[model samples]
Target: MTAPRSAAPERSVVDRTLSILGAFDKDNRTLTLSDISRRSGLPVATVHRIVNKLHGWGALERCADGGYSIGLRLWETAVLAPRSSALAAAAQPHLVALHGQTSLATTLAIRDGGESICLSFVSNDADAVACYGGPGRRLPLHATAVGLVLLAHAGDLVQKEVCSGPLRPYTRHTITSGTLLKRCLAKVGREGHAVVHGALSEGRGGFAVPVRDGRGVVVAAVGVVGAVDVIRPARLAPQVRAVADAVSRCLRADRPRVAEVGA
Candidate 1:
């Protein structure tokens, strides 16, 4: 009998290209060529050639420190993703109304993997220091009010993963303890909203409510942030919930169009 032929050795250009892109993620946004070589498991010479090509095409950018980071071109392309783009577009009017009514910083965010990614933010407070570099920035699941709301509805697996944490404390009040975070998440679920004080930043209080889709699945969180003393959860909850509900309504109304366009 003839011996079975062995499978050909793998050397895919697509796989190699993807490996380079995969080397950059949340914790490792910028990487030196050596880092990419190690992470991609490719030779330095191969990494060098690929990196140059990617940089030329605006898929990667060279940092001042001679490292590489995802380029703005990639971000600009990412925002056009149908789901997030549609959600943001549908929620924009409600967000604007909320900001106009509250005169505080309001944000819209969706849970992306382990973190909450801000999609839209509006603030008239000139003195308000930016956090996480503003919209498209990622915030910790255990810190912000929006994060709490998102985590509350993100299903048991995500909750357990987050609660089993080396949770970083952004401020003294941030819930680093898994047990404490679990209790807070329970409260958020029961109340249909989340309120956090000085957790993500000093002297900043936040309130958030869930924004659901047509199927009633929680898709995002809408939140407002202001001074600790000024944040009356009782008053803010109603406003936040109202705006979030309005956003949900808009999304549901436009769902058919969204599906058609995507199709």
Candidate 2:
């Protein structure tokens, strides 16, 4: 684990604020003060003080059940994040184009620690169970194509961090061993894209390609999950690359891009 760095000055306040936000994750989107203390490793007293401040600032909201969750104000502010709103807006037309042509499930994701966070999803077929992932959902970086592509492009430190298990598996096909996962990421780096078979969900296949800025930094990953047999690179590659190209053009033209997931 990365040694928890000592929070610096007002950054501590920032960190505390983030801790409060971080308290609400995939499994626990609403948490009580005790839950926050346990999850954040903060003292209950510390959580009390910070939660008071966050609630006052409208960054968090208290539920009728006496739990806390991310506030409307936070959601509104996050909409301003380029990857969430701007990039997503630009990519929507392209995604719609792909969705019409493929009649499959398409997703856009960005790197978050050792995971890929879904920013947007467009699907032509709702029957597929994997199409159920909502925006803001997080999945392990080593398990999905977007995660692998993003991890392939990330720094070595990030690579090592992801490679280190405690790697969680969602299915039998998940790459759990560090050595094998390392090899898989290396292949993704060399290949420039990745195809993951049932790593995130069964009966689904995910393929991803990186969307880069003009300077060549990967801004996001364009991906799709579809019926396991239909996710062939030959079929999906062009659309993924095409959407990525469009997003890149927007970034170069400085128009805007949505939900550009960062490492």
The models' CA-based lDDT, in order, is 0.84, 0.80
Candidate 1 residue pairs that clash: none
TM-score of structure candidate 2? 0.79
Query: Cα RMSD to native, each candidate?
Result: 5.5, 5.7
Best by lDDT: 1
lDDT of 1 by residue, 37-136 (tens): 9999999999999899999989999999999999988888988776579878877888888889888888888887679988888886754536633567
Q: Each model's TM-score?
A: 0.78, 0.79
> By TM-score, how accurate is candidate 1?
0.78
Candidate 2: lDDT over CA atoms? 0.80
| Residue range 1-263, candidate 2, lDDT tens digits | 88887676444777877877888875688899999999888889989999999898888999999999888998888888776675677677887788788887777777777777787888756554344465787777887788889888887888888788878887899888999989998898888899988887788888899988767788788888776798899878888899999977887788554333344
Model 2 misplaced stretches (Cα beyond 4 Å): 1-17, 41-46, 82-85, 124-132, 255-263
Q: In model 1, which runs have C-alpha deviations exceeding 4 angstroms?
A: 1-47, 61-73, 125-129, 256-263
